[model samples]
Target: MEPHAARPLEGRLALVTGAGQGVGRGIASCLAAAGATVAVNDLAPTRADAVAAEIRDAGGDAFGLAFDVTDADAAQTAVGDLEIDILVNNAGVPPGGGRPNRFAQMPPEDWQLQIDLNLAALMRLAQLVIPGQAERGWGRIIQISSGASSRGLAIGVAAYGAAKAGGEALIRHLGVEYGPEGITANSLALGLMEGVGRAGDPAVDRLIRGVPIGRLGRPQEVGEACVWLASEAGGLVNAQVIHLNGGTVFGR
Candidate 1:
């Protein structure tokens, strides 16, 4: 859709974390295309700037904001002056960068790292953005979670799953508490995406066979979903986890 063609998020500003590549980049691109001025964030300045430039090259408004979301001081400094109407908490990773480690074998430090990045950082960003949103009488908080969140105690990703579940739980509470204030909170529990889950890989192929869609999801699809949820049409939804897996799993 063209930016001038009845765009729902025109005049809004959105902050998308970890937006340098993959799913975050896709979300940022879509939000900009939907007429939202996007704050493209990444820990790396170059990556953030690149994505922002990509949006601008496509005729959308955007600017890069580089800061580690896990660093409270940095995050505050980066976002304190901006009036963000939408916050997309998409920065996260499992311990060892998604390498599998059993719960019993995982160290406490690893567990803390998982929580800090996956759960604590989310709350921190929400804290920074929600108050301004409340003052303005509108806001949207969207979490990019994993399918492991609702799967319940998976063998190799116990800590990661737990942290994601905690984030979802927090979203539910925020939805109920802030709904009257015109703020909506929800989570998009993802399955596998193109780069993240390749089709030719043996394990991914096995997983794809089980998926009713018979393919890995594209990042733009996730982006489109974020656009809808951030728009007025998705206002009725709150405190809910919308699964984006291709029928590989179901229900929150």
Candidate 2:
């Protein structure tokens, strides 16, 4: 990326959920490196603090915010205290894809759990952040979606796909409703990537086979993309879901 496009995040505050590990941590670090004051949030209380410490050690302004995003009111209120200009909803658990009873014995509750975490809560959080963004007249909300959202998904992940698609729709709607308020909302439809839960499983092979790039993606790569979209360079870009699936699905 060009130097100017990267520097727009200077002094901005970015709050990332599930930031204790994986893609969330990567996004937080990258935003901090790009000059945003990152607020690293996660369900693991200690881990969030640890990452925040590391960021501070690197001379980046950051702090830990540990809370379950499913608690809609609490999550919103906690983030409301921060001076966040960017929001990254990266929290969710991975469905083993194909699982229990060879998919024949899947429980109704199990399926609903995935949707609640992956999709429903995201919609709530976006709504939570809107008031702050609109008041400021500038904000960036970036969500981490999934490649599973494209396929029927592995046996156990039908619900995951549904949730992710819901998230994508929510993001697009937010873009339309809030872009005029100077708040840009977008999603990074992630490809298979190392470090993500379940990425190492052989079941991922089917997902990878279709990739033109023929490789796993990295959290830093997604992080860099977030930096771009959050920058002024991406001002005109809104409501677009950028699928970072290494040519798996182009221009979705």
Q: What is the C-alpha RMSD of each candidate to the true structure, in Å?
A: 2.6, 3.7
Top candidate on lDDT is 1
Candidate 2 global CA lDDT score: 0.79
Residue 53, candidate 1: Cα error in Å is 0.4
Backbone clashes (count) for model 2? 1
**Predictions in order: lDDT:** 0.88, 0.79
RMSD of 1: 2.6
Off by over 4 Å in 2: 1-6, 94-104, 196-210, 249-252
Candidate 1, residue 27: CA error in Å?
0.3
lDDT of 2 by residue, 130-190 (tens): 7888998898988888766766654456666678888888889999999899999998888
**lDDT tens per residue, model 1, 26-129:** 99999999999999999889999999999999999999999998899999999999999999999986323665579889888888888999899999999999
